[model samples]
Target chain A: MANEPDIQSDSLLTVEQAIANLQGADLGLRVYAAWWLGRFRVDAPEAISVLIAALEDEDDRTEVGGYPLRRNAARALGKLSDRRAVSALVQALGCSDFYVREAAAQSLEQLGDRSCIPVLIRLLNDQVPGTLPAPEPPQLAQPFDAILEALGGLGAVDAIPLIVPFLDHFIPRVQYAAARAMYQLTPSPQANHYGDRLVKALANDDLQLRRAVLADLGAIGYLPAAETIAQTLAENSLKLIALKGLLETQLQHTTPPNLSQGAIKVMTLMDELL
Target chain B: MTDSLVSLIRAVEDADSSNRLLEAVENLAAARLEGAIPTLISALSYNNPGAAVAAVDGLIHLGETAVPFLLEQLDAHNYTARAWAIRALAGIGDPRGLVTLLGVATADFALSVRRAAARGLGMMKWHWFPDNLLEIAQAEALEALLFVAQQDEEWVVRYSAVTGLESLGLAIVQAHPDWRSQIQSQFEQIALNDDSWAVRARVWMAQQRLQTESIVQPRLEEQPSPLSETDWQMIIEKLYDRKGQERLVFAEGDPRRYRELVVAIAQNPKPV
Candidate 1:
């Protein structure tokens, strides 16, 4: 149980009780209430204003508490899906807390606001060389994946050039993120050369890397990937996602042929296996 | 990425020595790489407790994505790997893990594996999926858990089975209100006749929880409740120390002695 707590269902409070606890004296209670409010997804106008106000909260006890109040607040705002939260979330991109900034970027994506694209693009390579001075046992605020994912989720096509370089980064996770972001920024399978690059990565010997690229190809609805994804369905672990992706690609094909046939075969296999 | 982190991931996948592989598993876990899930699933066969634990923790961190890979590992030739996979799948509590969990809970040769399966089988609460799947999985899981609770040879396994039943019972009561009286009778039967004081206490507690309000907080943290990690760990340590090679003599004897001991423990202020 290194760090993953065996979470039990919390004794939940009502909306009014939880909203009241948002300003409670105990930081844990406040954070718990913030999460509960989000989990419950209450749409009270008063709740939205309070959650928005909580975005500016300065509690920096992440080392002590697993989640910061502001991060939970940002996440709650996103769950609300209220467009009124767009400007505050955009400004939250500049929050000193890395997680708070990440949460805001993710919420902006969920809110489906294109206005925050330029603001989020700045966080694509935000990891610095050293730790902060104030937060003891300092940690760098790496917003790299959140930013890439947000850019992808927002369909920021102009950010493709910015995302492509990270595909060769020494970190495998960075490469994975870059591949996913590349797929997201590419408007269509025919729009960019990244599709070919991803297809090549699908044949890469690394299982994790191959799976990552396969998921991206699926997400982009790359029709040429139908054959490869269909073959991968032979591995049961990859079957569910592979079938999902192949079906997505199949729907994109206007003229049914070998690609559509392959998808049909895979779907039959899924029906038998899943 | 740190050079050590990348090296550890590589070593976990390709190391020639068990020691090297185990060390690599520990390092990868320390780095907390969610991408190292496949490596962790592979490391389960090493038969090193520390490495198995690290792998389990890593899989737990990966959460939902780790479910299918974990389910695949149930077919591993190594029983050790299968055991760890059952534990990890149980820890994740995903509905996808239910079928394998039931298979292992009822038929695994190893007591530890069966115990893990029994405990895990009860943890299945399929709220995320369609009601049809949820109803099917939950009913099958309950059937498997009930089998282990009533018939497992080892007292420890039976104890875990009861806890599993309790967990499934609580989930059913909370969500499936229709399953209340039937599950309550099952708990009361175990409470009245279970051989072990610990198992009986667990059943009584379940009965009490069911008999009481829907939202009653646990009265004691030290008690061997299914949800408390620390208490479960203690129960496991205590059970393993006694070594259940022979059946409990008191299991078939007077119920009053076991009942009194359970009451004293529950009512006492001191920690167990």
Candidate 2:
């Protein structure tokens, strides 16, 4: 009797117990079992399939369910980094329920597959942002910001093309995510080469490009480009970016007065232009 | 003994801004007050839809406190409030509140709130919402048909502010004042400069107005849209508006991960 722990463990077929608990008439108990199994990823493949089936359960209409089982599914998939789950997660995007859709979007992001970029990009066009339905009473207090982090973490190189376009979003948050994805996809030479092209682009035919390039050069903080930038600041329509860049670059360097040639040249140009 | 009841009817018939008067009704829902209830119910007689809404909203808030008193208003002179009383019972949302909200939602007036009450009736998920009405295809709202919800009339409504479909009507009526003068003259600006195409189109169709500019051409703004590829670079700079450790998380985002761009730059600080 004292050493009967093994018998106790044997008496309870744990996976069956978890699945049975997951099916309790009590919604909260069922959700808890699903959540624990999903998070621990210890569920039998049959149990994983059970949790997945529960994703479509009407927890939405139930007042007592701890979470819609779909979140548990997504979290489980993310924990497992199970590549097989990607298609199912992507399919969840169309769930009439908004929160479920958000979870699906987030799970796909967590998977961080190069294939998911097109899907993530496709979501950017979802101008009507929230898909999460209004939960029945005791509305969720803290809204989820999980998808942003998940997308940022995916760090898939293929996301570069898809994510780059959204960087110009009217809302800064969207652009911030795109910027984050950028560093993950293309870090070193892209930055250096991209910076070089930008400096060269200051001479582009398009005035807007030229103006933008001046600002880009400023952001690069490259000392060699400062003299050329100073020359362009003189009587260039792109003067403001040049002037700002020159000032910012000077500050970045903390140059001694003797090395003030770049700042001095830009100032003389500004006086002439003004 | 005082002025005949008919004259009391005449004065309340001319009141305005039904939406606010309706708001006034909400405050009275739990209050034991009686004066505002009758005034609001009396406004129901007015041709003004706003005044009628005030009456319904007022009665729903009055709950049991004003119910018996209001029963007389519905029973008299084929009064509109009687019909509205049943519908308002539905909007109150609570089952106990049902007798009142339903009184308003189904009330047979041509007013907008009455329709909202009916739809509200169908949406109630509890034992309260009847399954029978669920099959009743939602009657198209007069608010939608007349585009009253979209009316830019007065500063009270505008094209940009509306979140739902009703704004389409507001935009239409805004540009076309003959439809509803409640909107301002700047309806033209809404058509010409507003961000939403649906709003602009509604206003244009309502006024039967057109601008030569196609959707492809953005109307001129005080500032230009970002056009150059490097404009994206400007956007990135703005993201890190402040420098140093404050932007460390921003700098470390995937773009700057193991090959931390900000760190690399800081270590080899350029002598610009």
Candidate 3:
């Protein structure tokens, strides 16, 4: 139905330009290019290598102590799905910027590298000493939510005891993250308990927290949450995305392509949302 | 004005360091003196964000008393001042600022200005209008909010517009019961079609609020001393104000208290 030349030219031209910009002198362009490559899931070797190199970028620092380039590069590398990026991203875990470390941890989870487990585990106990009394209550120095999610996604069964304590973490988002990881590490009947914690989070007044819970539910494909997710006070599109994840998981487990009851329920909910 | 108040006003204009300027503005704002209104409005035009923020807070604290000066002194050339002024007016929620909010919500070049205006439009003190003119004023606000919701390029502005529409919709449905279906249908269409997930999510929340309001309306009407639409508006405003306070405290203190408050708020029935 569409012209082949136009499609090829459009995508290729954009990819090449993004690659060029990632290596360019402009800091903003480089940051944008890194995000573009990751957003489009560009998996070309050149793109991956350039993005890897970007992880070490020192040029794009913010005045308030942030490394925008490194953050974007680390995020892009994860989406690129290149094993070569695993080492660089692991090293980025030590970056001074809190957000860069957060982004690196999330990317490592996506890359699914088991070797990064020890480093991530150490991060669970990492606490940065505050200069002042900490105007707010003391939070984990390390990004616990990202680290917990990463550990869970990487299938670190030995880290289960470590993850359990965070189920009662002070922050609701962190608590939800712990619940998400707990379910992922142990997907038995007890997974429903973790699923219930996530369900309760849907009632949180914070929209951002609710959005994160939706993503976590979708990521783990917890079918028990499908109906509750549908009725939650979140965006219908997010509800649909979460339901799609549940349906996909159901289809994967079914021997035949025919919809299982769980899949049918997810589809029906998705239909109502649409 | 006292000499210290005059000094604080002068200090706001002459302070070299950002910290000093912020302190001066905060002191003046905390004073809550009528004479300091002009200086607070002028501070909105300053390059220091901390000073501007303090000034906006001060103006909001002055309430409707500051509205006339804010309306007359709104800077045409300074976008920063205009944006902060819009925030002040939005926070005040005086009915007199409705026209300005409507103007900027639809046409402001700055997305932040437009976003503030859009949200502010819904929060207007509709009770200030006489019974004869209230519907007309509300209709104008609804028209502007609908335009912004459907046409704004920024997702954040459109998100604010949806928020405006929801608040205004609650007010409208109570005043004219026949309009409930139309408002609900409009929200449904937006929920089904909006490009931003956040916007759609907000619309989804708005739909739930509308449905709850519809169910509660008859019970409210049956009361010995029936709650008027203005009473419902005041309650909504108080809840929103409480939520805003919770957010501010949540950022700087133990979140356990904030979480407890959120739970309490959620458990309580919010009459639309």
Go through the candidates in order and give each one's DockQ. 0.02, 0.01, 0.02
lDDT of each: 0.65, 0.44, 0.76
Order of the predicted models by TM-score, top scorer first: 3, 1, 2
Better candidate number, 1 or 2, judged by DockQ: 1
Per-residue lDDT tens digits for candidate 1, residues A34-79, read 8887777887988898888887776636763333888899999999
TM-score of each: 0.46, 0.29, 0.49
Place model 1 in a CAPRI quality band. Answer: incorrect
Fraction of true contacts kept, per model? 0.00, 0.00, 0.00
Residue-level error in angstroms, candidate 1, position A47:
3.8
Clashes of 3: 1
Off by over 4 Å in 1: A1-8, A11-14, A39-46, A59-67, A125-142, A187-274, B1-272
Candidate 2, residues A89-137, lDDT tens digits: the string is 7666655555666677666765666566455544544533434443653
For model 1 chain B, where is the 10-residue window of minimal lDDT? B223-232
Instruction: Evaluate model 2: give its TM-score.
Output: 0.29
Most TM-score-accurate candidate: 3
